[model samples]
Target chain A: DVKVTQSSRYLVKRTGEKVFLECVQDMDHENMFWYRQDPGLGLRLIYFSYDVKMKEKGDIPEGYSVSREKKERFSLILESASTNQTSMYLCASSRGTGASYTFGSGTRLTVV
Target chain B: TQLLEQSPQFLSIQEGENLTVYCNSSSVFSSLQWYRQEPGEGPVLLVTVVTGGEVKKLKRLTFQFGDARKDSSLHITAAQPGDTGLYLCAGDVTGANSKLTFGKGITLSVRP
Candidate 1:
């Protein structure tokens, strides 16, 4: 079975604070993605990495950045957290392009 | 931007009831996927339909891709309490580097 693990299951942050969400996959997948899920809005992609040191902006990448220094780890950075940024964040990994994805448990973020 | 629309955003029924969810899009896709997500967890791929007019079954769940490649459907037979969750449909466009356009999701509740 493939395992995708997120650094935090839940997080609380104050407004204007910097936040980081980490994800690691054991399957050695080549593609990793970050998405934020909100009610009525669905899952909007934040960023994705196809390979180590390679990154691409997804549909909604504003106020967020990603790091992929290694193949197994991907990190999502919130430049400055805001109340509107509170939502569930998900990380996913796939073997390669056009393949099925395996996702982490997700992190519920609360910004106050 | 590519978009997938899921119908009947929420459904509640007693155990042993059957239900069907529909996902439609204006644009054709290379492939379509269905996922089931429980609270606090990320979405899990239940099935993927690639070929047009294809039908795939997983136990009590049946998935069908439209002949036009612009729509899909998921049908659950005799839904149980354990089947309660959110159902999401995603599409992969031909030239989008395998990025998915996800629907808003359908919340299914099966009462015992």
Candidate 2:
């Protein structure tokens, strides 16, 4: 079975804090994506990487950055977290071009 | 603009009841995928429907894609308590490279 592992299940941080969420997949997929899931808003893509060291901004990338130094690992970085940034963060990987994506368990971040 | 709209934001019914979830979109898609998410967990891919007017069956769940590639539906027969979860529909808008847009998701609660 393909597995996407998220670093944290839950996170609590103060406003203006820097946060990092990690994701690793065992399937060796070529495409990786990060998204934030909110009620009634669905999953909005924040960033995606097609290859190691190559990244592209998604529909919502403000205040968030990504790192993809390895093929199987992708990370979502919040430079300065705010209250609005508190949401469920999901990581997914795909084989690229017309392939279904496999998603991780998701990390729920609460900012106060 | 919201690309996908899922009807009946929340549905609670008896375990033996049958239910249907609808996903509609104005934009055409290359493929549509359905996922079931449990509380505090990431979504698990349930089925993927490609080809317009296609129908796929998995056990008690039946999925159908619209002929225009803009909508999809899932019907469950004899729902079980274990089937309770959030159902999400995602579309590959570009039809390539795996850039997906997701629906807000439908929450289903099947009581025993």
Candidate 3:
């Protein structure tokens, strides 16, 4: 089975702290994405990478940055955590454009 | 407003009831995908619809893509407790990296 692994299930951080949410996929897919889920807001894309070291901003990337140092791993960084940033983060990977995404179990981050 | 819009933001039904949810857009899509997210977990891909007017079924669930390729629908028959979750619809805007959008998901609760 295809597997996408996220490093944390739950994280609590204080405002202004730097937070990193890690994700690793074993499917050898070329496209990876980071999305934050909030009630009523659904899942809003934060950042995505099409290849190693290639990152693009998504709909809600204003307060977030992403890293794709390797093909199998993508990282989402919250440079300065804020209460508004507290949400469930999801990581996904797909073979390419127009394909379905395989997602990790998600990391629920709480910025207090 | 989202590029894709899902109707009935929340649905609560009794077990064994039948329900249908919709995803719509004015812009065309290269492909549309449906995902289900349970509590504490990431969204999981349920199906993808690419061709216009295409219909696909997975056990008790049926998915259909509009002939214009601008909308989709998911129908669940004899809903069970196991069917409870947040249903999300996403589309690849012309199947590209910079334009894919996810709709505000519909939360379904199957009461026993």
Q: Rate the local accuracy (lDDT) of all candidates.
A: 0.93, 0.93, 0.92
Model 3: residues >4 Å from true position, as ranges?
none
Give per-model CA RMSD: 1.2, 1.4, 1.4
* Predicted structure 2: lDDT: 0.93
Could you give candidate 1's per-residue lDDT for residues A1-112 as a string of tens digits? Answer: 7799999999999999999999999998999999999987888899999999999999889999999999999999999999999999999999875788899999999999
All DockQ scores: 0.77, 0.75, 0.71
Per-candidate TM equals 0.96, 0.95, 0.95
Tens-place lDDT per residue, model 1, B1-112, is 5388898899999999999999999988899999999988999999999999999999999999999999999999999999999999988877878667789899999999
lDDT tens per residue, model 3, B13-74? 99999999999999899999999989999889899999999999999999999999999999
- Candidate with top DockQ is 1
- Which window of ten consecutive residues has the lowest lDDT sum in model 1 chain B? B93-102
Could you give candidate 3's per-residue lDDT for residues A1-112 as a string of tens digits? Answer: 7799999999999999999999999999999999988887777889999999999888789989999999999999999999999999999998987788899999989998
Better of 1 and 2 by DockQ: 1
Q: How big is the positional error of residue A15 in model 3, measured in Å on the Cα after superposition?
A: 2.0
